[model samples]
Target: MNTPVSALMPVGWGILLGLLAQSASAGFIDNSSATLTARNFYLDRDYKGESPYPAAREWAQGFILKASSGFTEGTVGFGLDATGLLGLKLDSSPDRTATQLLSYNPVTREARDEYSELGITFKAKVSKSKLSIGTQFPSLPVITASPARLLPQSFRGAYLISDEWDGVTIHVGRMDRVNLRDSTDYGPIGLASPNGRFRPGATSERFDFYGGEYRPATNLTLRLLRAELDDIYTQDFLGVLHLAPMGEGTFKSDIRVFNSREDGRAKAGSIDNLNVGGMFSYRWGAHSLGVGHMRQFGDSAFPYIAGGEPAVLSDGTMSADFVNPGERTWAVRYDYDFAGVGIPGLTGMMRYLHGDSIDLPALGGRDLKESSKDFELAYVIQSGPAKDLVFRVREAFYRNQQDAGSTFRSDNETRINIDYTLKIW
Candidate 1:
């Protein structure tokens, strides 16, 4: 396999992997799981303004292989996990390149036909705690992997998670390098664009974070997290979730808040931001209704992993995230469960979000606004020969307050996805 990125294994990784080879070859084989998934993804976008040679569209096929070994029998258990990813471009051209489905050639301005990536993690378990060293796919409030594309992003480093006490979980880790969602190369962490686009500059090699979650009650969860991207920025997060039974329905509330500031040396410049958001929902039978609100404060935009999808406050889907400097957003959504109507494998969702008070210092201190309407329909095979086969279609219409000549204009995006997984244990 010709992998796009070469891994520089750390010292601890070498030692742990050697131990895994010995144990996993014998005791660990008793309990192990292996799976492979095939994903076919296609995307198309219609620009409202002048297009980059017209609308951008692309299609790609992906294969993901995952293998995990059970822990060796002992007080100090050991195991190994591996992930292999491959993406092949099915339809793409120079005029329809750079849709983030595949890597693009700079000179030719064309997407590559194929790309691959591999990652491994060696784990040690003791009691309720586990430590992993090597590449990882993390999903946390402060940092997360972008799995919305053909290939998900990965981080190269170590992670430690423990749940020694009842109803409480602790997490600590550091990621020095990141493999972006599209490209097959590892690079430093950076800041994300307000519009969820890619941007260059303001990067850091060390991204250190530690956090914990506490569930004091069966229906309540609280989280606190802190992180620092060395020389770039520091961030703190707080989140709360609650669920209550209301008649035959359920009422849910989720709140998230973040505080960020420039770190020592301020490589990403003077950064300051406070993001707060919440979602309230009521679900009864086949129908669910939700409303959300979010606000951004400070002179700078919300800081997150650049070129990657971090689940910031009120950002759940891939279509759009209402996060801009000094921005305020409100959203309403509806969901239907086809299972309640005898369609056991289908579901649909629709949402609309409106945001205003966008501050663009780069565009001469101008303020703008944006809104997005999104819809999705999904289905999955429940059983039989095609069990677990899944299909989904998502569409979004986004309009921003930017001028027509601006690079960020109104556009419509649509994506179609099909996936199937096979177990090889």
Candidate 2:
């Protein structure tokens, strides 16, 4: 007979709680929930002769445990949240692999076997305000977890969120380390430190941020955000979100603008970047349409996640990573709900993205262009024994053009996800 970790978790937690009660002012186990999920994906790429890398095919499996509970009653309400994650490499080959679940060693051309992490957050609330210290999963314009792959990325930091004022909410935080979606180790972000090269190090620490959202009206929300990345840059953002009724359904719109500039040591020289984007969606019955455009200005690329040490580049240029000095992107999408067809919990969406005028340094010049088109189809089971089960399929075709070289490639991915939740309180 084998005892599963899930079965023994409550006993272990009970013992730990007893030990903490001996030292802590007050403690309690109020709520517990467990979830299990898995993902299957496939990818393929075809490059021109002597391309920098070969084609890839891979699949991944992941398990995540999130447990949270409220602390003993006191002057200030206290709580603790803990998360555990496990990732396994189910399938991969030298020619086809991804860094979503495991980091690939370029030299060895092999993926790591398994990766895991444990994160905890301690929080206190007082008079409509809350403060937390510990690792957190953040989703903001400046600092957001990248869930583009199988597992989502995480950050180690302290944060505070407050809603003391009517119609307004405020957020602020400081982060020092980032655990990417693919790796278990926590590393520093490029903007967080200035180590000459773009590599994760321990010497860098980013300054905290201040931001807020105001919703004076029921249908509109306005946001303002500002942050300073020590020795890297400073960024400010403004956004507006609106929701209104249209026909038999509703209309939604989102507009965002960002102004980024270099500060302090200014490692990446002087930063002068501005991004503007707007998305609009209209729904009539079971069908919806969405369109958006995003543009990047200045001589630098819009920085997001660094993708870790063995970074995955969008271009095929070795020794030269592609972030593009200036880029313009446009997107269009459509969605349909089966509920309108008398079937509930069934929805589908298809989207396409195109980009042009990319800035590349190694193409003998700075005039290069790249574009990609992706199609996706997904369905979720609404009821019955397999309720909440999901199936998805996606395909992407990418093309790059420039005076020096041109190449084309395509990739396909599929995933089957199933999740169930149990509440024990």
Candidate 3:
């Protein structure tokens, strides 16, 4: 039986008030803030293969409300945070369903008219450390939430972060359940997605991680972290980043690597993967150029929670991450800021990625190849009544030669997004 929070609040309200009476400092209500965001989204995907599925085209609108309260002043402080999300379907069909923008009935294959969810988290701070218990959106080298779609995924658990030391920060967390971006219910954590992945249907009750970042200098940062999905897999990561200033621009070098294997009972079976990737970029005033590479160098594919971004990978796109076993990917990218041309809030990006030598016995052995070409343009209102409004579009053309072993089909996709935010404080 699920009990309402109101019924339990009274049990602790007195103690909360008693603590507030300490009165060393009081910023709770004074530092509270709230914001509401409105998003209009449209996605179109078509297949260019001999597959039996139809094209997926969908349009939807979403609203997200986030509220946070400041801590009660003292040697130790407490606060509360909440997030609410609502997605309304405007266009969809039985054949065009499964776009991930809306939930559909399994039997009917019809998308729902709408879906919504709300979550709450309690937080406390002591000195330079903070503890949060409940809903969370974590972004770390090992794992992170994805907001690339209509809504972002959220987790339920506890996390502690500390920066008490001068040059290092620490993080430890345990997440037991997650609400997928397209679903309204929380479920066990798993390592797979609707496409391009591994260990489908394998799930665990807990996902845990610890470790942090160290900044030895103003221009360099290093990270060492560990994560595990209980009874499934264990993963360790090493990351280094450095920025150097050149004549009129700056050059950035980033490297990330992950070594993973089976853990505990190994429910996902003989899991073994060494995921490695990096990116080097140079920026000069209005233009930036970059090259990236990511590879899966183990017996199996890289593991990550379903519906989450493979943030550690340098060349993951809407279609593929080039994360299959023994696969290697290389990418080139270019970005331009229209502000240099008198359009202050406009920007554009173009990138291409290719992967080969994929080893998947389920399809074929090695020598498989997949490639993606992507283009994006975005603009934000800089002033007037709509200062924060944003407009963006993304396009991708993906093809696979080892085809079935990688991306299921050669395809094209286009996405358009318009967003606005309003402060409710």
Candidate 4:
């Protein structure tokens, strides 16, 4: 169950007091900001494998209204933040219902046409540190949300962030429930592992995490984090980002490492995994080239929060995480910026990834492989009356030897997105 209203009354009272204080001071109202965002999304996927059903296609429109008030003036400042989300299914049917763009009814096996949710946060600030209770969207290395669909996923919990040191940042949080991108209910956290992506047979009511980021230099950053899923698992993450000058261009590298194992009680049953990878890139003028390699070790695959962004090392594509037990993946990608050719607000990218040496114990310990290719084009209105309007198209092709056993079968997937944001001060 979610935190009850009785438990949240103190937070509500704090918000009311903050509002009174804001009226006493002009800074709160003067510095406040609000925005309304509209998003249109379309998805189509064609499956290929045994018992291949018809294609799954869906269309959706969403609206997000976000508002934030400035903190009241004092040694300890207080503020409030709110978000409203509404999603409408434009096109969907029972046969084409697994698109993840709309909520599904478990009993009727029907997709809902509409869903809505509201989130509120009461925040307090002391010096450079801030604390917030209620719904939050945290994009940390170890715990991150997903925004790839019509409405972004969100976590309901408490978060603390501190930047008291010049080049150091600290984060600590506890999440008790999650609202999936398409679902309208709060649910317990679960691990998304290879054996069970959706029904892991394990759930946790508490997820605690702490981390710090250090920037020792202008172009160098280091991060370390630890997370625990009550009795399910414990995970540690380390990441580094560095940039250097190379000839007329710039070279950059992003590295991430993860170590996970079953926690006390072992609700997920003896989970042990190690994941490491890095992406290196060079950018010159309008052209950029990058390559990445990732590896998974141990019997279990890398674990991450269900229905959220993947926590693997490699950059994600439309159809694959490239993360299987004993699997190694390599990816090559190229990007171009039209601005360098005098066409601002336009960009294009292409990527190809191959995964091999996958060990699937369920299939008699068979070794298999997979590969995928993806392409994307995006543009935004730069200076016209419809400025800030953005449009994007993405297409992907994936093939796997174990297509029938994978979470998503070998297929071709396409997505189209349109977004516009209006700022209301």
Q: Which candidate achieves the best TM-score against the true structure?
A: 4
Q: Give the whole-model CA lDDT for all candidates, comma-separated.
A: 0.82, 0.62, 0.82, 0.84
Residue-wise C-alpha lDDT for candidate 4, range 56-118, written one tens digit per residue? 889999999999988888898888889999999899877777777899775665778899999
Stretches of candidate 1 above 4 Å error?
1-21, 24-27, 51-53, 194-200, 404-408
Cα-based TM-score, every candidate = 0.93, 0.82, 0.93, 0.95
Task: Quote the lDDT for 275 in model 4.
Answer: 93
lDDT of 2 by residue, 320-374 (tens): 2224457676767788888888877767767666667776555434565565555
Query: Stretches of candidate 2 above 4 Å error?
Result: 1-19, 22-28, 31-34, 40-50, 191-203, 308-323, 364-367, 402-425
Clashing pairs in 1: none
Worst 10 residues of 4 by lDDT: 1-10
**TM-score order of candidates, top first:** 4, 1, 3, 2
- 256-324: candidate 3 lDDT, tens digit per residue: 999999898887777789988899999999999999888887778887777766766543477666777
Candidate number of the best lDDT: 4
State in Å the error of residue 255, model 3: 0.4
Question: How many pairs of residues collide in model 1?
Answer: 0
Comparing candidate 3 with candidate 4, which one achieves the higher TM-score?
4
CA RMSD, predictions in order: 3.7, 7.7, 3.7, 2.3
